[model samples]
Target chain A: MKIMHCPLNGPRNISEFAYGGQVEVMPDPHQCSDKDWASYVFYEKNAIGVVKEWWQHSPSSYWFIAERHNASDDILRTYDPSELFSERVDFTTGENEP
Target chain B: MTTGLVSPKRCADSHGDRHNDGLKLHDLSLATRSGVRGVKASEWLIAQSLHQELKTHELQPPELQPNTLVELPGSRLLMALSTREFWLLEPETEAQASPIPSGHCAPGVWPLYNQNSHAWLVLSGEPRAEMMAKLCGVDLRIEAFPVGTVAQTQMALASVVIAHHLWRDEAVFSLFVDQSLADFAWEALQDAMEEFNSVQ
Candidate 1:
């Protein structure tokens, strides 16, 4: 159990956390149905290697980010959960996009 | 025999109030302070320098690894792992409201807060594990959990701190949780132990 420092809540209690996979799997709301939304929200596949996972700070009222190596069971990095939700923008056109 | 009278020894009332004689149950009220505090190596060095009084054989120092359990003298068990680590399971006497001695750390440097908000439930008898498991999610297997071990986890929808202590006559556990959740946890355990004829 390697210690993963969380940016939002420094030094979180590890056991109170549940890993959600690959940080890059953003569902397309336009194409996704209610069932698809439900599955995306509830179900998860425990994949190995560079998987983006969701974690809940159940004890603390804070959301944060973490990176872990599933194959070796090692924690790579952690950051604030809001970091992933930052608004994306087209820097070339100076237009804000998500 | 023809009168169908039951023997006095066989009567239920003759057994007395069994629950009344059991361990006195108290309503624990306290708050939970959560966060990790670092322990300086200097403190460990000082504790080691104290007059070594070896009474009972302490378990061999567990390999320096994550989540390893270390049993110290005076029934003290320490959980070594993570930056915010080391849980001391002192005897019931140690939980009383008293200032812990200083010198392990520089005077007034290390602040130790009173963790009384942790409601402690002392469970004894043979069915302790069974009763506890019904409320907690952790596996309390004997092989996984030996005597003089401590675990921090959730129980009955509440965060719990549990330590197992083995005695010659009976086995026991010291369970702690937030004071606000005490009644909820107590009721949950009692309801789970209903089939076992729990006493107090």
Candidate 2:
């Protein structure tokens, strides 16, 4: 069985993980067009080489980032989301802005 | 101690009744357990421990590393799943009558409904790890998992948290699974334990 290393739980059977889609930054709803927002929500680059994606360890319900090669299906590196998001990000619309 | 909440496995008339000479499984669904998680959970738990020590004049609990558990006074155990998550387990004690409301236990520390969300099962035997190997992919032998180890992994295709610890002077595996899947997990464990029933 294929194995995937979880940032929190260590190496575990691939069956224990669910592949979340590619990580993407959210566009400000107040600034971006609806179509652009929709694209951000539902679209993926689906590139060939190494890509960063979100993966969840089902048992612990922990989500982390994994750099994997789509073509080879090899996980190059796995790390906690904290590595990328050091602090909370709050989004604001034109109406909510102070 | 008893809680108004009943375990999902409470309907089983034979819960905790089955036993084998070598391998035995006891349903500890009624035990007392609670959890807390957040960025400040570690410090919060340490502070709670110190407060308890000051009140009771008992030794303070030890600092727990991730994936390790430490025994505390009154037969309680403090298990750390991660630096931000910790479970307080008391297998021998039934839940208290007072309800534990769901909310923040302290600033940056949120309470978990483990007592209501999961069922507890304790497995003890000579070949306990060998039996667990049938369903779990991780190496769970004593050498690899040793006492005080906590593994949040899958078993029998179900999410389970396995804590290897000394209970009543004997090593045992304390498994916590989703409450809804309690029966299924119990059956799966029983099937794997069948072979060992005749070993001794």
Candidate 3:
């Protein structure tokens, strides 16, 4: 079984995680045209180079960013969402209630 | 307490139900479990003075010690499930029925949820380590996962929060599965153990 190193939980089996979609900033709704908004929602560059994307550790429901090469499927690096922000785990999905 | 699925009515001790080699499987449903969950929850627990109170008396709940399963003086078991979460097992003073006694919890620190989230189970016996090997990938051997070690991991196809605890000098593995999948997980566990019993 392939293992992915979780920044917080150490190396874990790939089965323990889910691939979150490509990480791209949402276009500014007020400034972007409707056509641009539509493209942003449905498109992915799918560039052959490395791109940052979200991956969730399902057991803990913790979200983290993974930089991977699209063409090679190589994970260049993985880290917690907090590394790039002040918030800890992304609470956006709200599946886990406090 | 005399309530819920794990209530006194449906709960039972090991019931002398030992596997072929004297392995004990007990219903932990009656044990009061509270989720001290969310990221940075240990800090919130510290702020509430529960950690201090436990520490002041030198009663180290499993999380505080480097060991995998240390029991407290009051038998309050703390299983730090993740970097940001923990589940307290056998809580001596469970107050989830009432408010958190104002001034105990501050805004945004980390909120505490009642007992609606998890279903509890315990795997106790001499062969538990061998049995656990068949169920999940994370190493449960004493040297690797130790006593105080806790984690949110996949077990028998369920996302479970597991904490190793010691009861009566015997190794005990406490499982906290999401309430929704509790029954399925428990059933899977039984089947997993059945094969071992038949073989032995």
Candidate 4:
């Protein structure tokens, strides 16, 4: 098998993961209702492209938000979920919760 | 310390009957002796010579993908592409003779426990894959999981290691998990399996 060096974890088996869909689309809180928000949270399109998704490192307790091409299954980039959340909300806040 | 063969006190026939009927409880006894001895956990790294009498079959390891099985010569096999790691098996009698390897054998550096405490459910028949898909999240397609492959994942919320032992025109999959979860896992499997009349 061809081993591709993943920028985040280096050479790891691609099989140990589930491709979660593309990134970049926000929930659009301005136009979306609570029902829309809830649906967005639970439902998945399982789409293919430049999408953002959550990856659970089962063996390790690490979670990453990654950007990748859906068709070719090539990961473009990845970042710690905490880092992404920190950018949008206060480190300690009402909704964010410590 | 006792000398010679240390046999645990065997319960009466009444207890044996209860155990056979799935009424009695059995503990995970590492002291349960098998005819063949096990290699020490410390000796995992040292590759011992193959037995002179037994035939050895070397198979090319499958590519790094999900639902892959690697068959060994005898009825034994290894499920290598599982999330947890490898699942080892052998014939019921010879299983005791198989040596347990130690050290970092598979990816993720997960330790391979002897797992003698677990019970196994060996399922066969035409609709085995269909029954599995009801409880597991992984795809159970024959194309996705060719014969001689294994999958280590959760089934019915319990951690399980499964392997497909291929035969001519038929496939058999073995399910191994903690003995504590045996009843729960077995019930869930039976519930799923009951949907198809073909499963008996």
Winning model by TM-score: 2
What digit string (tens of lDDT, one per residue) describes model 3 on residues B96-129? 4554422324444354453656767777765677
- Model 4 alpha-carbon drift over 4 Å, by segment: A1-98, B1-46, B50-67, B81-85, B94-111, B167-170, B198-200
The pairs that clash in candidate 1 are: A20-A53, A20-A54, A21-A52, A21-A53, A22-A51, A22-A52, A23-A52, B30-B117, B31-B117
Off by over 4 Å in 1: A1-98, B1-16, B19-36, B39-84, B92-114, B167-169, B198-200
What is the per-residue lDDT of model 1 for residues B1-200, given as tens digits with 9 covering 90 to 100?
01122223222211134643233222222212221224353244235422142123333222223334444554444543332334444432233445544443443224334254456565655455766777765566667667655565667767776666642234556576776776777777656656566343
Worst 10 residues of 1 chain B by lDDT: B6-15
- Which lDDT tens digits does candidate 2 get at residues B27-70? 88888898899988877866875456433534333356677887
Candidate 3 Cα misplacement greater than 4 A, ranges: A28-41, A87-98, B1-21, B38-40, B54-70, B91-105, B110-114, B198-200
Candidate 3 chain A, run of 10 with poorest lDDT? A87-96
Sorting all predicted structures by lDDT, with the top scorer first, yields 2, 3, 1, 4
Query: Considering DockQ, which of the candidate structures 1 and 3 is the better prediction for this target?
Result: 3
Q: For each candidate, give the TM-score of chain B.
A: 0.59, 0.84, 0.73, 0.56
Native contacts recovered, each model: 0.00, 0.81, 0.67, 0.00
The per-residue C-alpha lDDT of model 3 at residue B125 equals 64
Query: Which CAPRI tier for candidate 4?
Result: incorrect
DockQ of each: 0.06, 0.72, 0.45, 0.05
Candidate 1 iRMSD in angstroms: 6.8
Better structure of 2 and 4 per TM-score: 2
| All candidates in order of TM-score, best leading | 2, 3, 1, 4
lDDT of 3 at B158: 80
